[model samples]
Target: MSNSLELPSYLEKSAAVSERFKKLHRRPVKLKVEDLSKKFETPKGELVALNQINLEIHRREFITVIGPSGCGKTTLIRILAGLDFPTSGKVKLEGKKMEGPGAERGMVFQDYTLFPWLSVKKNVMFGLEIKGLGSQKAEAEAMEWLEIVGLAKFAEAYPGQLSGGMKQRVAIARSLANRPEILFLDEPFGALDAQTRASMQAYLLKIWQNVDVTVLFVTHDLDEAVYLSDRILVLRANPGEIDELIEVPVPRPRDPGQFLTPEFLATKKRLEELIRPPELAQNEEIPMIRLTEVGDEVE
Candidate 1:
């Protein structure tokens, strides 16, 4: 036998993935966070929501941030979006310091924030028009985005007239029509049903592939994070800090079928290990009260 030892299949695959992402790494950094920190004043005392967070998002990269509740994932994204501020450190976008909310960044939230009174086309054109584009130009651009999102037919419809998924498509179109350098989505599909959520994920990937925008998605679903992210930012709770920035080994041009593949499973397993609470990681079981009697079997 040869003297060389065999590496595990996942490890072997990781080598190929590293090669694939080399181009991605070479791309210019679109957003940079250095020693970013945030604190909140609780009744008890100062609670550090995020501590010394550092990150870099490459141009046109899709990054997902996931963690258990209280991990400050939302806080971190909010700061980057300029919707909130950090107590310390700095956020730079395209080599310029971010002071407050600007057109360079676009944000989508779990809630459908469409203006109910505005038609779908107008909703998309809202930003363009605000930026002083002529009515004809803004409407034309809005229709183009609606077409890209497969919602052109519904351009005349109102938010209340559309399905949950359709509304989100409009929201996405509105954000993208502005052509922001980076898009921040905080659980944009959390309210959708499982089927719709999966559909939205596919749509998002297709959009990301074609668009020239960078994405930073915040989600609580492991499957979602694994399926959508080029890299997953795993955070730990209690003075929320970075646990790991996982480069997903799953190959690109991804499909739903890849979820069961070794690479996907391996990455997901590692994420679980990192995000699992210490008690659970230690296999410590919680005591439960016996509400049902010994013979309470219903089946």
Candidate 2:
């Protein structure tokens, strides 16, 4: 008599995903957030953006933050990246307290931030030059990063000459050329079209796999969160706080095909539930004004 039990298909996929990232757990904590909170003085009074948020990002891990609007997703990343100060608590990187913006951290915003006057390679070399590296050395390192992002051929091109995705690739190469320990991306692909965005996501994974930097991405796209993250940090709105830190149950070396898999679909479903408001989740009806003729309604 066999006593072995068959697990559901989703569970099988989940188990595989877990096994795939088990080694990541063994890695040291790269970024640690403790009792972090932020508050703003508004016309209505004090508004809390983040409340007592705590997190530990593992070395070389890709982490994404997602939540409803005004959930402090941007605020959280800004604080972590040293672009903004937290009202309380501390953020540490590799056991050292982070005080201010430094070369060790890189950031990419949603908008293209390339300098119009500089060529692609020059854009990448800007930071290196600021760090006091010789022009030849900086240019050499910049070209190397461009090659890694598959944009070496575009080195001589201007920002205006490149596509949305290409500009982002240049931005990434620019950030990476600094050899930062962590890269903060605040919806870097938000400005791209759907097809371009998908390709950018794939390109990002390829870059992350090759680079040693840890990724902290802020996004509104649930699919992007599930696709890119080793774990997705879901924040709650109205005095933002950590709701759940989900370990994505989709195996790595990810591809577009996996989007339809049981595990991927299951994970995405959970995200929708968490991020969607209760009213929406319950499918509550909203009063609608009739603008067309009664029989004119189209299914």
Candidate 3:
């Protein structure tokens, strides 16, 4: 395989389509997250996971939700994907209240979520087949998405036969096959090795730049958050809340070379500080903090 996979022609943006997308990318938020909060009633008392989280995501925007544990990163993505409901506040998708899981949105979790019994193509076709899209059309859509992810050759393989990175690519293809308005990713590359993780990060950015969907990504990796997001939504733990929203001023069509550029490095350093703990931020003697201890969600 090539160091960089080739993108199919169908994935390319035509002159007219590109022009139209530029217009649609403007204001008139696609998702309105207003006063969002989630609390779970535990035996001890009300355990607040999120509080007063507000954000507006525009069409074709790549926004990443990140913070320490207990910061409600998972909860926020779940609410936006319609897998969970906010206790107080509302999430509007294109001006409509998001009630529950719908075809308009899709989610790719840390776990591949592939059926052990199904092949790659079958797994991607599951949703469309249920939606009443005939087998032929569903297969066609699945093939296109598989190609988009550089997994066209593995469409006949089962999950067990593929590597961790390949499995994640299949999961991504499955989600994109549905043509969702927004794709919610919860640490999709968290399980891979360092090398594979870096490769997948680049793959994800390639797909995102070509596709027209809005993205709400959740991650604990500071570098991943900066590399893939148009804006980073920083959350605070102890009842998760929005602390700040920082933009990635790097020019688009990003490549691995940009990772070393001054602008990219500056953005990454800024994000690290934004999420730094009060106790650690003041300690100049401490060299670094363990990832496991950082931002642990309130138990």
Could you list the CA RMSD of all candidates, in the order they appear? 4.5, 4.8, 10.4
Question: Candidate 2 — which residues are off by over 4 angstroms?
Answer: 1-16, 279-299
lDDT of 1: 0.91
Summing lDDT over every window of 10 consecutive residues in candidate 1, give the lowest-scoring window: 1-10
Clashes of each: 0, 0, 5
- After the best TM-score superposition of candidate 3, give how far the Cα of residue 59 lies from its true spot, in angstroms: 0.4
Ranking by lDDT: 1, 2, 3
Model 2 over residues 1-299: C-alpha lDDT tens digits?
15523323333445566776777888999999999999999999999999999999999999999999999999999999899999999999999999888888999989979999999999999999999999999989998999998999999999999998999999999999999999999999999999999999999999998888899999999999988888999999988999998888788889999787777777787888789876535467776667776966464
* Pairwise TM-score winner, candidates 2 and 3: 2
Question: Which digits, one per residue and each the tens of the lDDT, describe model 1 over residues 69-92?
Answer: 999999998999999999999999
List model 3 lDDT by residue over 1-299, tens digit each: 14522322322444654555466557579889899889999999998899988888998888898898878899889888888988999989889988898978989999888987999999999988988999999999999999999989989999999999999999888888888888899989999999999999999988988887888899999888878887889998887878888766555677888777666766776676678764535545655555576666553
Residues forming the 10-long window of minimal summed lDDT in candidate 3: 4-13
For candidate 2, the lDDT comes to 0.90
Q: Rate the local accuracy (lDDT) of all candidates.
A: 0.91, 0.90, 0.84
Report the error of model 3 at residue 64, Å. Answer: 0.5
Which stretches of candidate 1 lie above 4 Å from their native place?
1-16, 278-299
